[model samples]
Target: MRGWITFAVMSVVTLILLAPIFNIVILSFQGPQTLSGDPVWTVDNFVEIFTQTPVLTYLTNSLLVTLGTTVFGVVIGALAGYPLSRLRNRFARGYSLTLFVVQGLPVIVIVIPLFVVFAAIGLADTLSGVAIIFIAGSMAVTCWMMASYYDSIPYELEEAAWVDGASVFGAFVRIVLRNSYPGILSAAIFSFLVAWNDYLVAVVFLRSESNFTLPIGLQYFFQQNSTDWGPVMAMSVVMLLPPVIIFATLNRYFSIGGIGGAIK
Candidate 1:
């Protein structure tokens, strides 16, 4: 009876969470008739977006920034994380705390200074410039997350690798990293989402219309067509797809038995 009650409660919560998503999807299909109280479904919103808008360019820019952030963020996190997990010195501990502090700091607080610096260095209004911000913004959280995950892994595997003539770096690569797939992927997803959903940073640093990301482009679309609910919802749906695809594809790689099984 308790199990059934819990299931009922969870189902209600799920519905509540999914309600807005469902509403957006329905609105994306809303045609002229639906707006005028006739209620007919259509793909005109999608058609309009592809045909009349620069959605593809915006999508491409988002993809470039997201992919760049994920790659640099994950690699840097793993490299920094290994030391934090295994080191015991005062500097390591202080650096770890610094990461937490950086992660906690709001992006808005640092973006203006970052803009000044980037503009001076000639990186402003460029995709690479925006990607650098995403990488920096995400790296602290990624480092902490990867470090915590590495802590859960037993050190015996690396010790054994050392006995077998492996260096510390080799042991980390072959044992720690090979087993830290879930952590790396989680960090990648966080970085991807950060780059994907960023509006404030993108709008501030990126000036050219060609360099605009999906969020900026979506906001511009809304500004130009405030009453066009269909395309607005459709773009929202488009923004939702990459994260879903990423989670779905990487779900299989996140297993529990990589190094733990070998430890015993």
Candidate 2:
């Protein structure tokens, strides 16, 4: 009876969470009949979204920024994380504390200074410029995440590699990096999503229509035209695809495993 009750509760919770997503899906497929406050179904709106909106451009920008942020974040994160994880130095500890504090500073609070600095340096309103800012913004969180992952790894693996005619770099490659794949991929996803979802920074720094990311572009679309619910829902559905794909692609690495494979 308890198990059945728990199952009923879980089913209700799942439906509640999925309701909005289902609404979006239904709304995306809705057509001219749906326009009259009646829920009608058709594929035309989705077709028109592809035909009409500069959606591909916005999607491309999102992809580019996500890729750039992920690479920059993961590479820098691993490098910075390595020292922080293994070092016993006071400076490293102090810097780690400072990094945590910086992470707590919300993105909205920093946009003003970034705008001034980027414009002065002539990086404002450019794709590369957006990417650079995103990299810096994501690096602190990435470093902390990577450091935690590294902490879970045994230092002895690195030591063993060093004993086997390996330099620090070689040991890192052979031992640490091999074990860091899941963590690296996870960090990449986090950074990519952060860059992709950033609206405030994009709004402040990106003035050109061509450079506008999907989030910024979506806002512009809504602002410019009378309410076009069809294309709006279609674009939303497309925009949500990346995070789903990324999480699904990376979820393969996470699993329960026992050392040397024994049932305890």
Candidate 3:
């Protein structure tokens, strides 16, 4: 009875969360002229988005930035986390606190300064520039996340590997990381979301139409076609797909491991 009650409550919460997403899917199918009318469904909005807009360019830019952010964020986060997890000293603690402080700082607070620096360095208006910005913005949180996950992992596994003549880095790569798929996936998704949905930094840094990521391009499309709810919502759906696909694909790899069992 208690389990059923818990399931019922969670089902209700799930529906509440999914309501807006379902609305977007519905809106994406409605014809522009009938958005507020009888809800006539058509593929016209999807057709127009492909035929009439540079959506492929926007998609490419978004993929580049998001992929770059996710890859770099995960690698750096995992590498940096090693020291924080294994080292039980003041320096490591101080660095971990620094990461926490950086993570707590709002993006808006640092974006302007970053813009000035990027402008001076001629990184403004480039996809690579936007990707670098995303990497920097997501790095602190990624570090903290990876560190916390590493903290949960017992160090005995690495010590066992060490006794087998494995170097610190090799033991980390082979033992610790093999057990950290869930944490890595979480950080990857977080970085992907940050780069995928970013608008403020993209708007400030990217001026060229060809360099615009999907979020910025979507905003422009909405501003120009404010009354056309169909295509607007279609673009919203497009923006939602990559993260969904990523989570679905990587979720299978998320599980606890028996790294410590290897020792005894």
Candidate 4:
């Protein structure tokens, strides 16, 4: 009875999450004839995406920013987390807590200040400037994610390496990192998702038509087309592609061994 109840609950949750996705997929397949009867499948929307819309450009913009954020965020997170792991001081605890607090606050509260600062620096409407904000936004979350995952690692490994005449940096590079590759991959994936799924900051900072990321582009696509659900759904499918690919490739990293090896 308990197992049946759990299964029923899971089924309900899954349907709630997937119903809209299924609707979008079905809408994407609707023939492009003003939502008329013919129930046939077509690639017209996807083709129009590449050939007509500036979607490719938007895709490129999203990719560039997400990759840049992941690269810098992972580097900064790993570096910050490693040292914090070894420190037993009260200041270390306070510092980490402060970063957590800052990161946990709603980004809306700071958007106005960021907008003013960006406008003053001539960064208010550029893709590069928006990427900078994305990097900053993902940093604290990435740092905390990595710090906790790294905390699970054994310290004795680093201590042994240090005793063998390995410099602090060298020991970290050779031993600590070799062991933490999985957690690092997980952190990188999480940061990438955060940057990729962002819509609010992107909509706020991006002004030029040419600078739209996928989310902002989708918004425009929805608003521009009148009674064009097919194209709208197609745009959504395109947006889903990258994160799907990333999530699919992450199967190896989520395994017990991948996480366990990353820590110890």
TM-score of every candidate relative to the true structure? 0.95, 0.91, 0.93, 0.91
Report the lDDT tens digits of candidate 3 across residue range 205-228: 999889889989999999999988
Predicted candidate 2 versus true structure: per-residue lDDT over 62-105, tens digit per residue: 89988989998999999999888999899999989988888889
> For candidate 3, what is the TM-score?
0.93
**Pairs clashing in candidate 1?**
none
- Cα lDDT of model 1 by residue, 15-58, tens digit: 99999999999999987774558867899999999999999999
Give the best candidate by TM-score: 1
User: Which portions of model 1 show Cα errors greater than 4 Å?
Assistant: 34-36
Q: Give the local distance difference test score of model 1.
A: 0.90
* Tens-digit lDDT track of model 4 for 157-243: 777878889998998888777667677888898889888889999999998879999999999988998588888899999888888
lDDT values, one for every candidate:
0.90, 0.83, 0.88, 0.83
- After superposition of all CA atoms, the RMSD between model 2 and the true structure is 3.0
For residue 112, model 1's alpha carbon misses the true position, in angstroms, by 1.1
Worst 10 residues of 4 by lDDT: 255-264
RMSD of each: 1.6, 3.0, 2.1, 2.5
User: What's model 2's lDDT at 147?
Assistant: 88
Off by over 4 Å in 4: 1-8, 32-36, 256-264
**Candidate 3 minimal-lDDT segment of 10 residues:** 255-264
